[model samples]
Target chain A: MALLKIRNLTVRFATSTGSFTAVDGIDTEVDRGEVLAIVGESGSGKSVSMLAVMGLLPDTATITADEMSYDGHDLLHMTKAERRQLIGREITMIFQEPIASLNPSFTVGFQIEEVLRLNLGMSRRDAHARALELFRQVGIPLPEEKLTSYPHQMSGGQCQRVMIAMAIASKPRLLIADEPTTALDVTIQKQILDLLMDLQEEYGMALILITHDMGVVAETADRVVVQYQGKKMEEADVLSLFEAPKHPYTRALLSALPENATGDRLPTVSDFFGEAVR
Target chain B: MSVVLEGRNITQDYHIGGGLFGASKTVQALKGVSFSVEKGKTLAIVGESGSGKSTLARIIALIDAPSGGDLLIEGQPVNIALKRPDPVLRSKVQMVFQNPYGSLNPRQKIGSVLMEPLVINRPAIAAEERRALAEAMLVRVGLGPEHFNRFPHMFSGGQRQRIAIARALMLNPSLLVLDEPVSALDLSVQAQVLNLLADLQEEFGLTYVFVSHDLSVVRYIADDVMVISQGLAVEQGKREAVFANPTDAYTRQLFAATPVTDVEAIRARVAKRQAAREAAGAPR
Candidate 1:
């Protein structure tokens, strides 16, 4: 069964000149206990599409979707109250920058526990215990000490782990990771990916992994959806999509990556993708 | 055999905490780190944050003073005299920061930013000459001269980066300290930037001290690489020698975690994973 379904979704930002569609007619689905990666470049609209489904767009932004249902709930039509209750509880998200997602004023423990108290209806003591448990689960050293420490005290990798802990703390049916490892170092990135895979397997949750990295998608994702200017160019199992990318964009992207070899000139972005969209 | 820039056992210490007596704590940023870059070549320093790679670049760029050890520019030790020495070494070395958007002044036109350096250092080059130089540099970086009037904010992230590169090369520096220059861009855009850097190096005889977190980018552009971990040089050698035959355990771990360079191998691995996923996705 599909945990989250997005059909013909589009997001428009209202500018003084004119409204522009950031995400255009993107369609995708995430089944239970599956990893679906949305791969694209900077302006490819992968982030906008997921943000639209999350009901996180600002007042100036408008969203249009044929259907966006999460766990039989109409996400697109959800009231503000309904969406607030659902977010961070039923469909949690882990952003690329963890420290930014967390509140600087509050103790890391307080923020994590706050969600549990509100969503899980747990006592303060129990919520704090759960937060600590989550920290340990995400491989953060000294969970108790880390809980009391502020987000500023922790490293980027540690803060990201805290986010993962908070994200999985609720045991949401679906998790959306938006370039979770992009800001981290390669080794830490690998570790974070491994941690996410472990958590997903344990919780049996659906995952929407949005990233610009093809290597990351291949390593973790079960399926890949290649996006170009908010359009789905190709959808296949990670292996097939990588091994035999049918889309010219995907093929060109693969060829453009720098390699550790001799006499191989790196292909320019315009070499494959048309000169300039504008 | 001529070393353009060389740092000999450089150690930078920071004194933190302040009070009545200014209680100081010694924090060593670089511990006896030494490396050299040659003319018309690229040497990449690969590390994560706080790896002291940026500190190394700063020490080489003369942006920061080293607490210990010597920095030599073309065999002359960097000192007070050499530093403000009448635009000699200033014209020889330049730095391009990681955040191209933040690096360039948003208010200034692209041409003015390029002209700023030349006007300061090469006043002998007149107004018309400066304009021509700016246009030529912009063209070299793949941006058209029509953008001379445009601000940095008008361009895409990649184009802004091109402007930054143009600014760095405006003074015709012999050595460029590229600190995570392409790490901010999308992989596709990064590829284009990487290709451009390689071309620029050959054309202008520019030596690059490229610092990056991505091993692949380092592998792509660097002729030599030094892996620094926690203020220490763990591994250093020719690109092929270090990657293909890494001596240090940390370097090996990094390589293993990173995707292998060979596309055929990566494809094969992806094929296996996809087949398994397809089978699992099927009715079972």
Candidate 2:
């Protein structure tokens, strides 16, 4: 059985003007130890679907699904406490902006230790030791000193490492990384991606990487799901998807890559679907 | 072949942490870098964070004076450290920053935002003329005159970037220093903006000093490339030469680390795997 299964998932947010459908009905499933990549632009609902799965969306958001399950447990039927207990331990997520996601007021060490203690019921000393261990595992230099430093004191890469440490502290069965390397430089992005893949292998965790970067998807993902404006455009194994994209939107996106350009101008998505799509 | 902007051994140093009695520390952000941008050509400065690429951009744009070395704009020596720069000379070079949202004024209308440069630098121009130029600039950048009354908050990120580009062109600058101009945008919008930039450069015969960390974007836009690492230029040559065969170890490492999306290569690998599976008679 798949580790996660969702069918007909939809997410809508209430706004001052009207209701906004962020995620249209989409079905998704992830097997154990598999790497699935969700590729999309900014408003394509890639992040929103995962946020809905983690139950992290605000009250303004209304999420509905026909079937949503994790490890034989029904996610839709679970109570708030039960869902909370399942999410942070079994299924963890890291956001794009690590520095902004972390609490500015608290030390990173305290934050991770609190998660270890509350989620795993670890003793104080044990939580401290585990926090250090997680930090070291995430390749943070001088874990002892970084524990004392606030989020503001560290660089963007270091803050992301801290976020990864916090996410993997409880040894999650599935990890969701949303644009993990987007905020980093190319070299730093390479390092972070390698580290994430390494940790995913070590823990035997299913990884769901959500990014708009085709290069990253090509390099890391086994299977790919392309989203466009709250709709799933296409899905296939990574190589097949890249070699022969079925959807026009997918073809347009692949052509828009600077490396694939044959002329001075890059063909945009609108060029494929027309200006009406925009 | 005329050099529009030339930097000879440009250097920038920042003094840090000596508020009251303790000795200050001098950090060299740019360590004597030299380069030149030809007329109607794009020179890309590629580097990682804290690699001093942005410092070079600022120096080229005349926003900050270098601690040492000469900057010649159209063969005229410019040393802001020695004396004040002429307004005309300053107006010859314009800059477009990375984040369009943060760079634009939320309270100001788009029309006013476009005309602010002219109001400050070319005050002798009439208000009516400034308004005409701003609207025309807007149209040139793919935005319509109907967007004149709207605020920055009313526009999307792509439109906001168009407005930013239009504003930079108002003064008719010969050189534009774009510091990661499209990095904050989405991929599709990034391509659009890059196309717009290419069109505008052709229409105006503008020279560009583009500072970006993304090698792929640089490869697309840059005629000449300068790879900076740790405040030094590791390699500098034509874009094709540098990209095809980089001599510097740091440049090689950067190229190796950057993920390339080559469909043919991936297809070949996939075919090989399938062949292996077939040889083993694996079940489908």
Candidate 3:
């Protein structure tokens, strides 16, 4: 059975200009232990769609859907209190900016412990022990010492590991990582990605990896969803998407990558999709 | 081509956390870095974050001074450590930053932003000529003349970057130090900006010191490549040579980490799948 499902989901924000639909009606699904990547550029509504799934969208945004369910629970009909209980325990999210996501005033250990204590209802002593284990699992060096360091004291990579530790504190069945490695160095990016995959496999968790990087998608994703300007352009297995992209936008995006350049003028999306709209 | 810009033994050190006679730790941002760019050519400096590529760019662009180094522009020695760089050298070198949103003034119109550089660098030029020049630059960067009146916020990230590039070119600098100029844009938009840079370079005979974390972009734009790690230049040579066979361990690691789509392999696989479907008489 699919762990998460959305049908005809649409998101619109109320702006001063008027109501602008950011995400048009789109259907998506995530199966247990699957890695589903949503790839698109900024303003494509890829992030907004995922944010809606996690119930993280702003109050100004109106989300309507024919069906949106997670683990048989109707997300669209779920009350605020019920979602608050489900979010951290069963579903967790990590963001692009590691430092900003973390609390500066609190130690990394306290953050992880709080997640464990609140979500999993663990004892204070057990939570401390579990936090250390989580740090180790996320591949942070000197896990015990790192627990005491504040977010500012650690490097970008280490802080991201701390964020991961917190996210996986409850062993969430569904993990949503939005551009998790975008801010880190390439080497660190590989390490964090490897760690995420390892944890996902070990815990049998479904991962929704959101990013604009095709290279990253090729490396980590099992299935891919390509979004363009709030609409689903294509969806396929990772290999199939790369090998035979049906959508002109997806093909153009792949061709535009500098890595694919052959000492000639690059082919932009405008070449395939016509004049720029936005 | 002649050597347009050169740096020798560049090093930058920052003093951290010293108060009231407390011993402050000195962190070296750039350590004995050296490279030279040829006239009308692009020299790419590739590195991960905290690798001092940006520091090297700053020194080359005369934005910041290195603690110890000698900088030469067209074989003329310029002491960048001075509070203000020599006007002639400053005018000869310009920089474009990574963040288009922050680099451009939100309140200023695109026309004024483009004209500001011209007015400051060439005060004797007539106001009418400056306006014409700005409009021409806007059109040159792929934006229409109608966009001249728009504010920075009105333009998209890619368009704003074009304006930034246009502004940088107003002085007709011989060298442009672009520090991750297209890193903030979307992939397709990145290609557009990169193509614009190449076109501009050919048209204006401009040299470029391209600093980027992306090796693929470096391969596309750079004639020569330098790899920096922990404030040190690990490797430097022709772009093809460095990319084909990196001598430094760090450079090799960076290559291994960078992701590249195997287009040919994917194409072949796609063809094979198509053939199988054809043989099976699969419906579309």
C-alpha lDDT of residue A127 in model 3: 96
Return the clash pairs for model 3, or none.
none
Candidate closest to the true structure, highest lDDT: 2
Q: Largest DockQ belongs to which candidate?
A: 2
Runs off by more than 4 Å, candidate 3: A274-278, B263-284
DockQ of 2: 0.67
lDDT of 2 by residue, B1-284 (tens): 89999999988999999978999999999999999889999999999999999998998999899999999999888998788777798789999999999999889999999999999999999999999999999999999999999999998899899999999999999999999999989889999999999999999999999999988999999999999988999999999999999999999999988888887766764566457547756443
lDDT of each: 0.85, 0.91, 0.89
- Evaluate every candidate with DockQ and list the scores: 0.57, 0.67, 0.44
For model 1, name the residue pairs that clash: A239-B270
Query: Pairing residues by index, what is the TM-score of model 3?
Result: 0.95
Of the two candidates 1 and 3, the one with more favorable DockQ, higher being better, is 1
Q: Ten consecutive residues with minimal summed lDDT in candidate 2 chain A? A: A269-278
For residues B216-280, what per-residue lDDT tens digits would candidate 3 score against the true structure?
Answer: 88989999999999999999999989988889999999988887677554455446645754775
lDDT for model 1 comes to 0.85
